[model samples]
Target: MGRNTRKRRSPLATKVVAGAAALAVGGGGLVWANFYASAHESDSSHHRTRSAGAQVATIQCPDVGQKLRNVPRGARPGVDKELARLDEQITEAYARLASTRQAQSGDSAYVQNAILGPLKSKRTAALDRIGINIRRGGGDAPGGLDRFAECRGMGADQPGNGDGDGDNGNGNGGQDQDNGQGQDGGQDGGGQDDGQNQGDNGNGAAGPFADDFVDINDVQPNSRDLENGLAANGDGGSTGSFTAVCGVNENNLFNSDNLIVAPGVDNGAHHTHDYVGNQNNNAFSSDDDLAGADTSCQNQGDKSTYYWPVLRLQDGTQEFDANDLGGGAEGNVGKILKATEAEIKFVGNQQSDVVAMPKFLRIITGDAKAFTNGVANANSSFSCTGFEDRQVTDKYVLCPEGSQVVRTSNFQSCWDGQNIDSANHRDHVAFVQQDGSCANGFQAIPQLQVRLVYDVPAPTVENGQVQNPYAVDGFPEQLHKPITDHNDFINVMDENLMNEVVDCINGGEDCQ
Candidate 1:
């Protein structure tokens, strides 16, 4: 059942094309061109498998290439060490373009014009040695050196009023200004085309986190994006029939050091992970770099290693430090794209029979010390939109009229079919049969779902501080309150899409 489509472009379009080199050339692997959207194949012969969030159908728009003149009029003392070695050569050319998913390979256009085009003229000649004011499009316009659309909140468009901050007031720049009359209609500057966000599938209209903060690709599932598929329960609940989407690449979810935890130690997981598909991972990484890395996950050898833990929104009095990194240090905070979009559903018995999912598995969903420990780890979900039954630590939750603001996580699908790699990473794995099937000895797999969206109402001081309109990158600095939000996954699935998710749960078929 794979028929679905929606396309839209021109959000600052940029193209380069050309792919298929299979990368991994120098070593740290990263190929390219591996996209899959839908496929059902299962005509009795048995041995098909592949229907759990099969996404990656075109999500381009990150070229931020040319745009940096000559500016060397003021303090140029090695301009912060040449913008920290061009931020480690543009995060190693986006980790070799996320290990060759090929969006213009040839080493990602030679690291985007030989290392992000002269590191975008030494980051505007070191922000013109202080004095602030690069203003081309405002919102801290770094363009040329391409901060990758500032992790896709869309580098300062300013006016969407969804409130991430873009109209130049500076809480970090805003753009998604709604008009469809949703989040109390509109805020910031209720007009048209200032930062560009009117409506008609453009987001900024139809409000309230409009189907996952709109960059638009076919997010028509309104009602708060199906409000957790209407509380999908277990058994024959069919759990919204099936859902699977994973078109990510927002700078591999906050990068700088490359996660190594032991062997020589890199940044390790000291806070920072949204990752998605394999790029070689960090916290020390292994299994032969997950069998020679390179994946955004379309079966390309399924080099496992998906990640989590990077949500921290509380700009009420300042708490959004997604890695900072203007001059380096303070967590570097660069890569941006995920305004909220990564789904995968299948809670119970869409069919059930499951198996094939044992390759270095290490899933851990939610509770990263749930705000210093609170216990409740059953699948894990936090709410605040009409008080979906209430559960708060208050990182900034006002919600009232029509309600909105949520963070959901659900993994742990009772595996044990074998062993991938586990010590304490979560006892082998278990938890499914609540009608979803498996239990007893344990088997069933595939059930990711990691929803996150926020509209944030109340609190926006500005100069005096207090900003937080829902942000996340890697929490620490006193845990930004909000019960220390959490999430983590690592089941490099791709032994034929984990045997087509065990033939779509033993052939009950209902794919995405």
Candidate 2:
């Protein structure tokens, strides 16, 4: 199948829901009253009578890739292509949902009939193709794949909240202004608002509404405890670290393709990403291509690839990709912020001597679809420079003056020993257990930790709206939720460099 390079259609007229009242606060601050009502309420009496209890916020479909654990090697390429098609289908369906708010408010069944129904049909055909590919690869096809085709409309309060999932139940229910005293003891500003009722500023073309941010001061100190057995102190484990001095993508290596997840498919990520290290990385780059690629790292031996979604300030700046499929068209707009500092480090395991990571080993730390897939695989950490100890998983932190925004991704440290990559791109690597030991028979490998710092203007939140808000690039339906932030890495290190990394970790020394 060829790549889907079609540009998204221009957004429709702004849709504003009824019952939202504009209120003036003290000091001329303007706030929208009942901001959350637009998430579900409608103005049409006939529609209200027909579906008074429905509050569909976003579409929720089961993840097909996560369930295909036994795909044969011969079928991987076909399955991956079909999976990317599935994502495209969802993106198109969500766009239709966002563009038809008026029609949805007039008839509850319109969404079911017009959007989700067609999506399911497309997914069913794709699923059947996947089964056929598996069978052709000399493997038994998994049964009941069509069961994953059906998708449903989810409300703001449901398990998979419309725009994205939050840490707790803090869906798009409006901001909790009680000094951050909300569920889960952490304030996430009620996730991302779908811009159902706000004007041009609340346009759904690019999201990350005012409710997606919470003042860092309002957030309670919730630092996580360190992993056990990290202290070297003559411990019988690898205690050293290897730091790779990769430039912060100064070469302007950017793309919308995700080689680890959707190889051979373009626009697989549906969002722009900043890349460092390996220079020859794209949807079609093979192991040989990466091995011979130029490196952005200060050391030529480290040809590993590291990438993550770009962060953008929603200040209406027309970037280079403003009109492209993965940029403005996919709801990832604004000025792309370059990381002031990008730190990539490899550290030893706490409980055992780390082994060399296999060449071409691929690892994806966080879940890019965590907004809809839930936080079980979400590992993103958003914090401030001075307050790095305090991190939030689902909310954008409003840093104080002179404090820069920080994003940290700690990749899995245990390897399953046999596969360099897995069907889900995760089964090959696993995080250490609570006791700092690799579970099952997995072997400990050097853990990759990436830290990125951005100096951005603090967003202004007045009334119930935000100005100059910044958010990570994400899927159109995700609304740029912080929980969806993720990182990707592919190890293409030469054999000598891989050995040096293992030796340095075991020798209790830090080397660059």
Candidate 3:
């Protein structure tokens, strides 16, 4: 996308309350405590924590989509449309909340009356429609969906109050060591000293407060254990890898539609995504359309669709979508940054041989609503190129000069063998068990691992003020938290190419 010339107004000053303590562990590791309420918990404590003059950071609502595990195939289209509408409602409410800091500081109930109440009514209407759609499609309508209609304003101090799952407790903060940190140097480490006020970007609507960033140096080197019995080459498992040569979106295919979650609906994602591989991808694309369309991959036989939220630099550079619904208008303003390198690879399982992924099998690896939905499914990982040994899930990694930022997503590797899609879009696939074996008769499939590298200018965090920040585009209410980063994929490889991938991996031969 090209840059636009429109300049954003200076961001307004925002005051936030920090209630969590900073723990100092051995080896100089720092563990930041979480203060927000979990989304799955009741809101009684959340209400008790609210008071006049408290800063309402974002809105948190129950993830309605995750609850509908059995909508009939015929009803999914209509239900998906309504779900998309619910997202739009949240975005609208967040916009209003961001703009009304003055009123919020004065009247404690103002947010409840002006923003959340209206949002609840709209969500209730959409929920009603969803139930009707399921019934019309020859399925039993789920009840109590109305309980998910009411959203609450989350403050900064209420631990787990719609921020995340409060799992960043260990000093390591759930980081991975592989594919991390590049050896480079430039600029001072970015992050505010403990007890220092965080910087405000002034634009509350499009957030990523200064506190959202952390210096790579202060993070402890804590890496998670391998999943699915994965180990070194001596384990006697599928050890080969297959790489897909899809350039880093050089073709510049961009859209806000999500075919897997909200087919036939425009602006379903409410955020722009950089699309590679399949050239014909959008809300309305069908299997037939995709099969006939061109692709960006070097091997045309692999026409799988791969996409993820585009990262943007908040440098007041208006992008081509500046005035569009999914762009600046939805609080996702900034200069979009293309990935410097995109590595798409498929590997084999540790316990057994792998099977080919079903054609048109759709998979989503991370939670898009993680900011408000909790971190039960949060899978995005971030680190500096040279410091790959240290990764953090919630805070954006402030890469030092010369070093680049890295994002890695490892998709689920087990499938049920029958369905290509599930009612909730997750039941059809699963991650391997702790023993590295597929559970419940599920078969192991080639695991897809995507590593995206970006040469992002490290954001400056000083005296609680952030000058320019880079964040992934997401729903307005999400506030561009790094934990919300996710990836999407649809397997459309022709049988020949799919078989070649399986054989290449099973034979323990790296191929491209």
Best by lDDT: 2
- Ranking under TM-score, best-scoring first? 2, 3, 1
lDDT string for model 2 (1-512, tens) is 11222232212101111111011112111122222333453335323222421345557787788778788999999899888888888877776666566666657688899988998999999999999999998888888989989988764333453322222211112222211112421112333234434312432333465666777876666543334222112255788888999988888877788899988877788888898999888887889989999999988998999999999887767677665566666667777899999988899876789989999999887778776776656676789988876777677899999999999888888888999988777777777766677777989889888899999999887665577788999876666777778999999889999999999999999999
Residue ranges of candidate 2 with Cα displaced over 4 Å: 1-54, 156-158, 161-206, 225-236
TM match of model 3 to true structure: 0.82
Q: Assess every candidate by TM-score.
A: 0.31, 0.84, 0.82
Higher-lDDT candidate of 1 and 2? 2
Give the runs in model 1 whose Cα sits over 4 Å from its true position: 1-88, 91-116, 119-155, 158-222, 225-234, 237-265, 268-282, 285-307, 313-347, 362-386, 389-405, 410-458, 461-470, 474-487, 491-512
Q: For model 2, state the Cα shift of residue 462 in Å.
A: 2.1
TM-score of 2: 0.84
145 Cα displacement, candidate 3 (Å): 1.6
Q: What lDDT score belongs to each candidate, Candidate 1 first?
A: 0.36, 0.70, 0.70
Highest TM-score, which number? 2
lDDT of 1 at 364: 62
